[model samples]
Target: MNAPTATLHLLPEVNQREVPAALIEALKARFGDQCSTAQAVREQHGRDESSFEVPPPAAVVFAESTTDVADAVRLASQYDTPVIPFGAGSSLEGHLLAVQGGISLDVSRMNQVLSINADDLTVTVQPGITRKQLNEEIKATGLFFPIDPGADASIGGMTATRASGTNAVRYGTMRENVLALEVVTASGDVIRTGTRAKKSSAGYDLTRLMVGSEGTLGVITEITVRLYPLPEAVSAAICSFPSIEAAVRTTIQTIQLGVPIARVELIDHNTVRMVNAYAKLGLREEPLLLMEFHGSPTSVKEQAETVQEIASEFGGNAFEWASTPEERTRLWTARHNAYFAAVQSRPGCKAISTDTCVPISRLADCLLDSVAETDASGIPYFLVGHVGDGNFHFGYLINPEDPKERETAEALNQKLVMRALKLEGTCTGEHGVGLHKMGFLVDETGAGAVDMMRTIKRALDPKNILNPGKIFAL
Candidate 1:
């Protein structure tokens, strides 16, 4: 594939709005001990995993229930103050930052599994519940939540970003899994969208609109999500490839052949070395595909055999299988730790993570070119991917003190995003457009579409008091 030239553009800055003293006093009085203006807490609630520099919020409100969230929003709305919703703060983009100062409404304390309709394969949960906690709560019922974004991110945060991870290739993303939602609008009024029924042709798809809105539109208080039955028989395997091209080719073919692969992850040679050193796993350091299949005993065996054959066609070797549950957990746990491993590879350095995704047919072109570009940039980096869905991330580690290194990483990121857009893909497949990708959003959606989005934003949030300065500029 021919790589396109990327021209970087400076994102427009939004002026910081001051929080009135009266509002802060009212919040302190209402929430009592729950309201916090302490510097440490504000700093903790201000930023996420991203490198964007922004001041923390003026205060934080630890909400314990939907009513708490509503009351907080109502107070913020009354003051026309921006309310930034905080979850686990695992967002790679700067979604949680209170760039325009207001109050950070934290929902981490509202974690509760409200109800489970096992018969309908659906569960209603508070916004603060983590994905792992929910699965553990319902695992005995033979149901599981499969969207794992590496971090044990809260379901609300995952839904806000419309996250998808390794299992997304098979189970789909939050966009498909979330059945309904109870959201607090900018006006601080609670509204429920969608229902338990499978399909609906009723009005607008408000649930989907809110899922990836990144808190600009509203705050999600509760979610009703579809769950999957635990597979009876499962098997995990890792196959090493002679080259990145071969591994990507194998992934494309597997997807094309319509194989029911539960998860297929690509780890570059550099990433493999880092994982081996960090996670203490003894595996060949080459371009590798860690995969899993789910089905009955006979079907699982058949799927594994078929995948092995496909991998073999592309110079894949050492097909290590992890059949037992403990073994599988170890393998996946190591895989999930790729980010931390990459970070530790270069101590005292930070990573500028890239989330470019292209069409499956263009996976080889997109990934190979990306790898070559990163290699030539002279910045230390590691590559990992959910190749089954044509989405991947590159953790470009750089010393924060070095301007030249940070510049190189940012330039490379721009080129990668442009290449994905050229290949008919997106700047972000799972990670939503926080402050990091505001300019890219305009590029991907065009000016008119962005205008429509702005119109909607103004319609819903007349005062622009929601999570301001995110997704797009007013």
Candidate 2:
């Protein structure tokens, strides 16, 4: 648990390429006021929630349609300038950073629900439509999208990151829910992949390829995803445990027993206290599991009973149910705000988050060992997880000005990732391999597989103008 002396170099070396005046001129001419060179606009679009600092992009293009995106990208191609797609800017990794100077193609203006096939259980939306907005727009249809991701991230950003969240245990992640896409490739050509159909065996599976490409492959202009009917019966509950191991064990047993849990989240004692302080809630300060069930009324009751039995076996306290919709919303909102709460606890500190996922059977081993090591290291941290799916996060709060704390936090992250890999898990469960996890990507996927990725990137983006210097160094 000793802190390593050398820091983990998370940010890539900045190699800003020039954005010629001619390119900016062409953009302004084509889109008029939609193209901006103001420092505020450029700076706002250049960064995300990641703890990295770099120069802002030279210009920002507020694209309102596919044609706008294509034209802007086409112009950038001419100047060999990078075009980094911008969504809601909720990405935890450095996915939105302009490490290599480029134009920030802001798509937040394109928010719209283009079509809703209620009968087919599918909805197509513009890339900038946020998840919350999508659900509100489609609520009249008695259906909703389930990939929450905590943040009200844009659908395009979620699709790019292959994101999942609390309900992922039952409804699945973006990788499984997304049915098709309309992407603007590096050459600024608009192409469609897949269809409204549930499954396909087409050539190359390009839609799957683009789903987790993290904007390195292309700009996601439109997305068609599956939706589910509002559950007939729903119930939410919280159960506190004496220790993290007991809570994790309860989750392991619940999933092992084949319960169809809609959402199962773990918040360690540290995070629980933070959430209480930030949200002004009266939740018990202990390792806690917040869960929800969905199905017929009889089935929901049975599922809850079964889970309660399992929890009791693991020394879990009596359940605290949040049955009303308002109650459930308030509870989940606090859980989503856990990261912000932790950051607020340590003023002027930035969080370096980890996203490692392992098999359901190995959840206890991977999490408990890491918890012990982190405790011994003496770095302030917050732990939360979608443990039903064996995916979790550890947010290490470090002062930006403190070099020693940064090194210690990064060192802890490296050990945790390597341990997850050893347990046959992935370095990233949802967050893509942005600048922060590039080296671990190599370790997890091996040199040969990463080389194959490089080959595909080169073929698609010969000039490397589409989100240059991301995923891997080309």
Candidate 3:
């Protein structure tokens, strides 16, 4: 297969638009202490977990309410200034970068559970609430939201990126969980899409249109999402495999058999070593599958038995169960911290993370080839995945000052993405196309579909003032 060219490694062009002085003055007068032009604050809002960096936004507006958001957006719109939304700053794809020199509209202070319709299994919340915070607040209700994207990412950020996680193999992603939204259009007009109702045949599915728009179409102010009742029985287990291929094959078969596994994650031996060093969990050094099942006690047991048989067929070790809540939390926490563990394994290094998802039938084929290529390149990398859903990540640790390392990592990612696309998968399964994946978006969706996206963007955001220079160019 031909390697992706070096152009894919280039950052998006920087074209800083003028943030007029009058606009800043207007925002200050309107928002009072809520608006800030502090250099430090602007810098914090300017970047995310991604490797790319650009000049910080000219100012930062800490919006505390929908009116605050609307007014700030309205003033920026008047100056044709870009307004990039800021959430928990956990995005790995440069989604929060102010590449075109805009003002960062921070909604973190707006976090609140607006309403909870427990009987309806729906809850409406401000976009700023993080997933962990939401779950903690709703625990007493015996219902919880299942889309946990590792990081305690803001609901708005998760919704904007259409994020998924280990639970997605059963619960689905933000695209399916979000039931409604209250959005501020590019014109600073507040509008509502979808409803508390589970199904709708109403006009357009604007909720979906905005769910993964990455803040390009509008600013999500409020989100209503579906929730699930707490499982009567929950069991977590870990099974080691002789090779990544064997673990992946076990996952493929488990999925094919339609086992209702709640969460199934794959961690290579490299990652296991890193996690063991960092968290001191003393996990066995081998490729393993960390899985969980949720259902009635009988059904959960049946699912686990079936999976164990499938895994054993592929030479997987007997299941090691995390029978208690604390044990399960520890194992899952270690899995979630795999990226940080890998980063710390080599100090003074940053990770170029790749999110490539393939079809279940082709998971072993696509993953094995990428693994071989990465190993041959001799790059220090960590591999992990929500393999039950055929989605995975490879975090390549590289020194920031070393251009050569960056190029090598990008090349590896490009090959993986191409392989995934060829296998009828997506370049990104959860992380949306930020500046980093713009080229891949075109490659995967083709120019015509992207042009149609551009058309919709132009029509909805004529000034290109809302999170400009992201998702796609004008």
**TM-score, prediction 2:** 0.98
* lDDT (10s digit) by residue, model 2, range 233-261: 89999999999999999999999889999
lDDT of 2: 0.92
171 Cα displacement, candidate 2 (Å): 0.8
Worst 10 residues of 2 by lDDT: 1-10
Off by over 4 Å in 2: 1-7
Candidate 3 per-residue lDDT over residues 310-397, each given as its tens digit: 9999999957887689989987977999989999999999889999999899999999999999999989999999999999999999
Report the lDDT of model 1 for residue 443: 68
For candidate 2, list the clashing residue pairs, or say none. none
Q: What are the TM-scores, per candidate, against the unseen true structure?
A: 0.97, 0.98, 0.98
In candidate 1, which residue ranges exceed 4 Å CA deviation? 1-6, 9-14
Candidates sorted by lDDT, best first: 3, 2, 1
lDDT of 3: 0.92
lDDT (C-alpha, whole model) for all candidates:
0.91, 0.92, 0.92
lDDT, candidate 3, residue 116?
91
